[model samples]
Target: MTSFARKVANLLGVAEDRLERLAGGDLSEVLLLRRPDGRCTVAKGGAGIGTEAAMLRSLAGAGAPVPMVEGEHDGVLLLEHVENDELFSPLAWADIGAALRRLHERRGETYGWPVDHRLGTVELDNRQRSDWPGFWAEQRLVATASILDRPWRERVEAVARRMAELVPPDPPPAFLHGDLWSGNILVAGGKLAALIDPACYYGHGEVDLAMLTLFGSPPPEFWEAYGPLEPGWEERRPIYQLFPALVHLRLFGAGYAAMVERLLDQSSRNLSTTE
Candidate 1:
């Protein structure tokens, strides 16, 4: 067993009789821990592991479906093991929609997290900003400048400068699960089971919704149950999507760069129409 698995087992007051190292998609160690009694839990260890623990606590406290943190140590967190029973059904998606809406209702005073964190190994700046558009533009888009090609960088900067005009900025800030993609969404028993790996912050709730639709559109049931979206959300989705696309472009390179380009082009065209 890896030292990480043993450390978590010890922290949780269990023997490491059954420890299975699982596939952690990012820069972390993941393990399934089972005690002699057959009870199971998950252990994660790595940089920023504690940040996720804090997010799970906050999200669970706000009524979002998340695993209970069983124990935590330096860069290691033990979480309640939620068994996956089945994929999401329309009814399950409705539950997810309701849960996310409740989570968003937990508002914050500003548009950033209290501490800096990572979005899949990329350093994310959490410096608070009262203005949402400027916050998104600087923290999310323009932040990618150092990694991008000159042409792409210039285009992105141009859009960032015009972000306030292209995207509506009047929505009140709310709790956001900063990285709410399909992978972070867990389903069991044909229902939404848990939300994991949040890069939590205070922003428009639509930021989470936009990430959900980035790789693929959510089931229509999600929309039906999510209720009416914020005004101008449709017009702003492509712009919100640019944040993750830029993150991916920076992480994985040109394949995702194409996605960033497409989103920026769409946002630019939309800006033209508005003008």
Candidate 2:
């Protein structure tokens, strides 16, 4: 911990005896600190940690449960420490799906935040257009293409330009957990308890469901629970899933590169054959 870390601790009212460091991501360091009264706070210190802090604050009490943000210190943030270990079970999947459905059901005119925000490491601008296809093409696929390798970039661009016609314009837009992979959800007592790391925006509800299914659908129960609001989703699931594959390719490395390329090629073939 550095002077900056200490200052952040002071801001959270936690003293030396109370603080214990928790492993954090590459950019931030997290400390779980107990106060004199035994109350606990999760202090996160680093640059850009503020986005998650701000998002949690803005989306607080939007109906679903999440860590209640207490304070944001210059480059750090304090949140009510959720005291559960990582969700590591099959049942946890169902609970998370149910919780996600509840969140997606949240009604709003426009999905993205009014101001600029980051989705984990990626910058998000849901402020563009309410048109989901346009957003995916311009902001998501195209915006990230600059960093992708040449062959992969061209393939993604080709698929993206025609994505408007491939992805149907049905299923009225619902709030999406933009990045709802298995990792971002939290579970406790065998129940999905909270949502974290939102890249929230509005789009076809299937986008969230499709993402959940991307890394292998959470579990049978999860799909069953979500099936009511979203029935018969398999038809377009493959198409919707391309977004996450592309995201992984960009974020991780060449390992995901092949996966993205494969999906893009398949999508192009499917579109072309149909035409």
Candidate 3:
């Protein structure tokens, strides 16, 4: 083990004889540590790990299924090893829907989290605001504009300007898993074991639902468990989805540019219909 890993193990009061690397996203390094007695723990090390630990604790407090935070020190976060299955059963889909519903029920008085967070190379400007439209416009949309080309930046700015007309002026500020895709979810024993790797904040609940649909659609069982959404959720979905599309464009490169343009066009149509 590296000196940092050894220090983390000592801080968490664990003695691990073996370390195995696990799949991780762009921002973090994940590893599984096993003791001679068969006990196991997962350690994630990178920037913002402590913040991830706090987010997990917050979600767990709100009755959402998440890995228990064992300890956090320096830049390392220790977590309980959660078993996950690659295949998601219908029961798991429904369970995730229900879990997400419960998570969104935990409301906040304002939009955004107390501290800013990062997604890939972009810093999420989570400065709390009372106005949802303003939050979405300035913090979510316009914040990404700096890294985009002039044309794309102009398009984003135009949408940001119309945020008040596009989104609700003041929806209930529901807690959100700011990054909610299939990959972040874990299933075991035909149920949702945990929602991991969160970039959490308080925002429109539809933001999460939109992100859930970004890569693919959830099953009908999911919607049935989640219940009906607000009437205009479909139209607002593109607006919410645009942020992640932009993030992907920035992170993965130009292949996602078409996805961004498509979502932008959809968002424009939504504006036209509203007008």
Candidate 4:
């Protein structure tokens, strides 16, 4: 394989004096390239990363804080490296909230993206659907159920069947950063730097917030700037969390299955409360 850094340099028409690989997760390898002029850019290489450049471009156009895509060749995606300027601050989280609000404002006619992308190594379904609940149930909940053990899989499928009733209807289809965990959130110099490694789609906006709150809680400033979430948002979050928990189960192993089971149980209880 032609090295990712070399491919990126050729595509960007630069002569790199230094190329250092950065620590990325299992799906992609990231390289930091410095040209003789001291300009730095990142090169991401993976088997199926070609669509990510287009996603970055689209998000940038919609005012989301994302890296500017420099170019691409083969599986190497060249993006303008954001220089880390500051640590995370209240103002930074607030800025992220506002920027994300702007991003969600840029909506589509249907729920999904133009192309499919990966949430880790697993395929994320972006096939458009007119109905949001059906999209979530089919694409997110049931589609991910296949990786579960037979009993858990059956239970999850039952939850999917109840999705129409479980989730409220007629919320506007909002753009989503399909995988929006805090790890994908970058901060520099106490300011929001970029949202990286997206699996873009159009769905319920709460999906992003659910993932953000999965590992840790977002600061109060973030919620203040983002505006109040939908009524009963706290209850709906576990249902949204199921997608990523299931993603973890598929990618990591059965250890994550317990988390998925807990979320399923919570969903079941919440469903009863609603009923």
The candidate that wins on lDDT is 3
**lDDT (C-alpha, whole model) for all candidates:** 0.83, 0.68, 0.88, 0.82
Tens digits of lDDT, candidate 3, 92-119: 8999899899999999999999988898
Candidate 1, 1-275: lDDT as tens digits: 66876787677776776677766556577888776677888888778877888888988888888988987777777788887655767887888888888888898888998888986668888899898889888988888565678998898898888988976675778899888987788888767889888899999889999999998887888888788886778889999998888888877777886788789889999889878
Sort by lDDT, top down from the best: 3, 1, 4, 2
**Full-model lDDT, candidate 4:** 0.82
Off by over 4 Å in 2: 2-4, 13-18, 23-27, 46-51, 87-91, 229-232
Number of clashing pairs, model 2? 1
**Clash list (residue pairs), candidate 2:** 111-202
- Residue 9 in candidate 3, Cα distance off native in Å: 7.4
Per-candidate TM-score against the hidden true structure: 0.91, 0.84, 0.93, 0.92
Lowest lDDT block of 10, candidate 2: 111-120
Q: In candidate 2, what are the lDDT values of residues 60-89, reduced to their tens digit?
A: 655666788888768777788776667647
Best by TM-score: 3
- Candidate 4 structure quality by residue, lDDT tens digits, 64-134: 88988887777777788887554668988898888888888878888888888776668878898788888
**Which pairs of residues collide in candidate 4?**
85-189, 86-188, 86-189, 86-190, 87-190
Q: After superposition, how far is residue 186 of candidate 1 from its true place, in Å?
A: 1.7
